[model samples]
Target: MSTFDYAITRTLDAPADKVWQAWTIADDYGKWASAEEVVLDVRPGGAWSSVMVLPDGTRIPLSGSYVEVVENKRLVMGMDVPGRDEPVLMNLELAADGEATKITLSQTFDTAEDRDQAEQGSNFLLDSLTAHLAA
Candidate 1:
């Protein structure tokens, strides 16, 4: 655990492959991921961007790239947020938990404030993912 890092774990009632698809595929990602418009190139070093639309129609743009990608197992990405000088590194790990999949999400930021702010959004995004997977 780094100085400015946070981890969240969730058990989703879906296979790892399905969860991976939800995270990587553009259309599937739009259903969750807390973004209205999403562009994802899931391969290593590929481009990743999305616009999260607020209820008031405000769009917050996020850009990033896949630092490491392991299909159905793990994904690590460098995510750029506004006001951050460096990209935040996000690691998502998936493993089998009987009929469900266990997802552990970790994010490393430059400062504690940045990490705390990002943590809120991460929780919302994962909650969205949980609903999407159940549906």
Candidate 2:
């Protein structure tokens, strides 16, 4: 199986703990993750799921599980679409940069095509996070 990875880093206007909370809490997550609704259980082995309502009212489901978690520091998860067999791995790292938080998000996909397919959505999600932090 072919594999590919993508990584993005952003400086958030919030503290590390606050940024972490934005990711681990369902309601906070929706403010940036582009989800109309979300359900996130942040502990290891816990479920991460959400439904995103598009502009045309189409709801897309995203589901995942936390494989590893370290509060305010790092989180890793196994993520995939409902009907897809492609394995997706996501890792998020947070660090303090003065009063701001530096966030690094990395994703690995089973195939280059799979990684390419998710590029736009991944960027959009991270961009939303940055905007949320600014607000």
Candidate 3:
């Protein structure tokens, strides 16, 4: 099995609390998550949904379950893409850095292909989030 790791860091102008709220609050999350169709149930065992609209307008649905959550600190979830037999674990970390916040999103999978796909997808979403947070 192959493994891959990818990380992106953004210095948000807002404080850590604001950035944490942006991630935990449903309305704020939808604004930055980048999927045309998105849903977030932020509690443990809550369900989440995201439909990414491709450049050609094709909608890709992603569904998942939140397995763990720590207020203002971390979020752990299991994500399942269409046609994928196994769910991938998603771990998000939030930290305060002076007036800025450092957020980390990591995905671990059983296979290399899964890890690769996750890196690409997370990169795209993180880029969108950076723009959103900056604005």
Of 1 and 3, the candidate ahead on lDDT is: 1
Clashes of 1: 0
Model 3 CA deviation exceeding 4 Å by range: 82-85
lDDT of 3 by residue, 1-135 (tens): 566666656566667778777766767776777465567888999998877676678888878988999887788989886678867788888888888778888876667776788788788777767788789
Lowest lDDT sum, 10 consecutive residues, model 1, at 80-89
List the candidates' TM-scores in order: 0.91, 0.89, 0.82
**Which candidate has the top score in lDDT?**
1
Write the residue-wise lDDT of candidate 1 on 65-86 in tens digits.
9999999999999987677787
Provide the lowest-lDDT 10-residue window in model 3. 1-10
- Candidate 2: misplaced stretches above 4 Å? 82-87
For model 3, name the residue pairs that clash: none
Error of 3 at 56 (Å): 3.1
- TM-score: the better of candidates 2 and 3: 2
- Estimate the lDDT of model 3: 0.77
Q: Which whole-number lDDT from 0 to 100 does residue 54 have in model 1?
A: 67
Local distance difference test, each candidate: 0.88, 0.84, 0.77
